[model samples]
Target: MTVTFPHKTLPWLLIAPQLLVTLIFFLWPAGQAIEQAFYQEDAFGLSREFVALENFIELLQDPYYYNSIGVTLVFSMAVAVSGLSIALVLATMADRIIRGQMVYQTLLIWPYAVAPALAGVLWWILFDPAQGPIALWLEYMGIEWDHFVNGGDAMILVVIAATWKQISYNFLFFLAGLQAIPRSLIEAAAIDGAGPVRRFWDIVFPLLSPTAFFLLVMNIVYAFFETFGVIDATTAGGPGQSTKILVYKVYEDGFVGLDLGGSAAQSVILMMIVGLMTVVQFRFIERKVQY
Candidate 1:
């Protein structure tokens, strides 16, 4: 009475839709982008020149392009570390609290559900240098806080905004990791006269490493690629070009400047950077994961 099916064919059937969608939506566009990188468009929006690597050479030689790369790396690393650290601390604290845990968890994780663009808009209202809540507060305290001109303040805002958006996601992952640890393990450690620090180091941290590794990669990816909205809203690459991350630069070059070919080169470089980073992260973390 059991139905038999071809397992080999079943796997393809299950993945056929995804593969087709990927081909149509991702691979096709990627191919087009590569093609576009080699051609220059004129005023009439026609491909006027077959430029080969000319666009790429220009991008490589541009100081603004190099500066954008530096800004992107700095912002990405700062957000990743700060977000993961805060999330880990908050997760650990939440795991220990007994009263109103659900309320606190809901509040902490709610930020993850909000759209990044919306979050950027909200922060814009809160940190406006002239008259926003935070800016006004600074002024009231007789503090001179002008993010518009100061690169450091702009970078700090970008990092803080990016980190705030991602901490909830990291928290959710850490919370799940914490919940998966068996109470019996902690009890056994306690029975063996292990103190809080000893138990955490000996047992808790080892179990949490998997979740931490996953969050590290995810947070880095989000901070690198997805914080463009916040940058666009808050700095627009800024008073100068201080906040122009690679993605923002790509958008600016392609759409704003209409230097589609140069932007495509930038895009290709960004793709390579992200792809390399992901490969490196996987190589390093693959050995550390338990299961």
Candidate 2:
């Protein structure tokens, strides 16, 4: 049965709220950022000068900017890969539960409901060099764990916080994808002498390509943009700028460093990078998706 609106304007009315929100939140801010990128302005906005591409050129020449780019790449990849992999494993385990399924699933998904900053603070306390239990355990194991002065440790800390925050969301999607696979197919594969691993690799995983692809895009975006709170709360892009991902750099420059024009330029670049990444994923990666 095909249901159609009697008037063409009815469909527009149904989507008007969403369109209004997009305009107010996304498009308006994006336009402001773009406009600001072209001008050098003081934090107080007392003086301004139009400097076409000067901010961008300065960023290109700055070693710290390059470092931020590299850090962002590593952080985003670690978050996306580890978050998806761990979530997939957890989802598989959750799907196998014969009883208390909802309880287990709820526990797994609880992390996603936590605010990003809160999640970062939770992990920050867990890995505190002085009092954190995990840090003490690592010390007992002869591994030095200190995010305060150690750059590598700080990177790892932020990555773990970001990945942990995203796992529940990925798990929900993965569990749904796993559950959607027909049991008959698995039973047939089992009868054909295919083990659980074989069946999963050959059938289950391929069927999950669509969900994985979608999560991949979302995770990358999250790592790039939404993890700012996580970084700020935990590391503040500290340990000599080791964990300063691009988005945090925008905040650091704009709000803290008082370089509004440079910050806006960075924001514009970050937006373009994410846009290009999404385009590339759909162009190349989607080709491998089964559906």
Candidate 3:
């Protein structure tokens, strides 16, 4: 038996609130950013002049902007790969456990409740060169871990913090995906003399492809945007802007430097980049990712 909405007005009314929110929150701000990108205004907004593409032109010539782009790409890939890989392993182990699985899952998932900035702060404390326990241990190992002075160390710090926060989210999805796989498939593989590793690669991994693809896209987006808080808290885009991902650069320039027009241009560029990534995922990657 098929059921449909009784009234046309009811369906529209049901979705109107969500549509209104999207328009107000996303579309409206995006429009403002585009408009602002084409104008040059004083920090206090006392004077304004239209200067189309000038901000973008300057950004293109800025070496630091290029550096930020490179940082963003590296950070996004690192966070996504590390977070997904860690989460998948943990989820697989949890799924295989016949006992205390609930306890393990609860512990794994609770990290998701921590705020991104807080997570960054926690890592900062752990890696603080002066008093951090990890830093002390690293010193004992003859490896210096001062993020305050080393660009590479700063990047590693932020990446670790971001990945740590996201692992819980990826774990939840992967665990669900693993559980949805049929046990009969594995049993059949076992009967065929396949070991656990071989069965996982042949059956379980292929079945989990869809979930992995979804997480990849999500983790990329999170690294690009949501990680701003983590980077800001941990490194303030510092050790000479090495940790400055595009989103953090946008914030640093707009709020701290008060370059509104330039910041708006950067935001527009970022939006285009994210749109292109999404298109690429659907056009190319999505086709190859099994459903």
Candidate 4:
């Protein structure tokens, strides 16, 4: 006897719970935030008036808002590129090794397991002025180390912390992509007198584009949003708001400053920027992908 299955109803049944959760948790909150962005609020988070676009206009006119936008862009790009480059290099190197490969892969990817907050604390321990090990070492070595006095130091520390935390994730994806390539293709390229560098650029690189693209998008999102914990722990939006990215500013405005409407406006701006970036990236890369 053969069994019959109602495929359409089963699929919907499986997806119903997920759809309901997303609507309740994600869609509802997003709609509320969008609504809040346009409304004025009182001290108790009560809606006082319909401000209708005023918050958005204020966000655009404010210099601090513009500065936060610039900081967010710079931090996101720096972290994404540095993390991807380092991860790609490490993944390629690991792909060439033969012995104890799993051990090395495990060790290299272990940092991805660490929470961003924990990683931020570790960086704080390393870079904290007057108290950190690096600070003490610099003092002993007669080298002045002052992150607080230097804006560049703060930016560099944030970039380094973000990149370090994300590199392992990118490394794992790249390694998987590298391993998926057929050895026969590489052998053929080598037989046709393709050098290692030539093979990499012409063959391996193109094949790995999908993986690179995936990581690029994920890295941008992570750097933009998830790195807030790291930034908060390390600098708390800094000695002079030097390290305050858009999301950090949003958090500061809503939670610390008690300006929920303003924070919602900032959040709306971030969502717009992220949405634009994603659309532009997809349009740019979709054409380049070879089927």
Give candidate 1's error at residue 186 in angstroms.
Answer: 1.6
**Per-residue accuracy of model 1 over 1-291 as CA lDDT, tens digit each:** 998775888889899999999999999998888888898886467547898999899988988888888988889999999998899899989999999999999999999887887777777677788778898998899887778898887888778788888999999999999999999999999999999999988898889998888888888789778998888878898868888899998888788888888888888888889899989988987688775
- lDDT by residue for model 3 over 187-275, one digit each (tens)? 99999999999998999999999999999999999999999889877889898878989999899889999999999999999999999
Q: List the residue pairs that clash in candidate 4.
A: none
Tell me how candidate 4 scores on lDDT: 0.89
Candidate number that wins on TM-score, 1 or 2:
2
User: By lDDT, who's the top model here?
Assistant: 2
Mark the regions of model 3 whose C-alpha exceeds 4 Å error after superposition.
Answer: 1-11
Task: Please provide, for model 2 over 56-129, each residue's C-alpha lDDT reduced to its tens digit, 9 standing for 90 to 100.
Answer: 99999999999999999999999999999999999998999999999999999999999999999999999999
Q: lDDT per prediction?
A: 0.87, 0.96, 0.94, 0.89
Candidate 4 per-residue C-alpha lDDT over 88-134 given as tens digits, one digit per residue, 9 for 90 to 100: 99999999999999998999999888988888888878987879998
Q: Which residue pairs clash within candidate 1?
A: none
Between 1 and 3, whose lDDT is larger?
3
Ranking by lDDT: 2, 3, 4, 1
Report how far residue 240 has shifted in candidate 4, in Å: 2.1
Compared with the true structure, the alpha-carbon lDDT of candidate 3 equals 0.94
- Please list the Cα RMSD from the true structure of every candidate, rounded to 1 decimal place: 2.9, 2.1, 1.9, 3.2
**Which residue pairs clash in candidate 3?**
none
lDDT of model 1 at position 288? 80
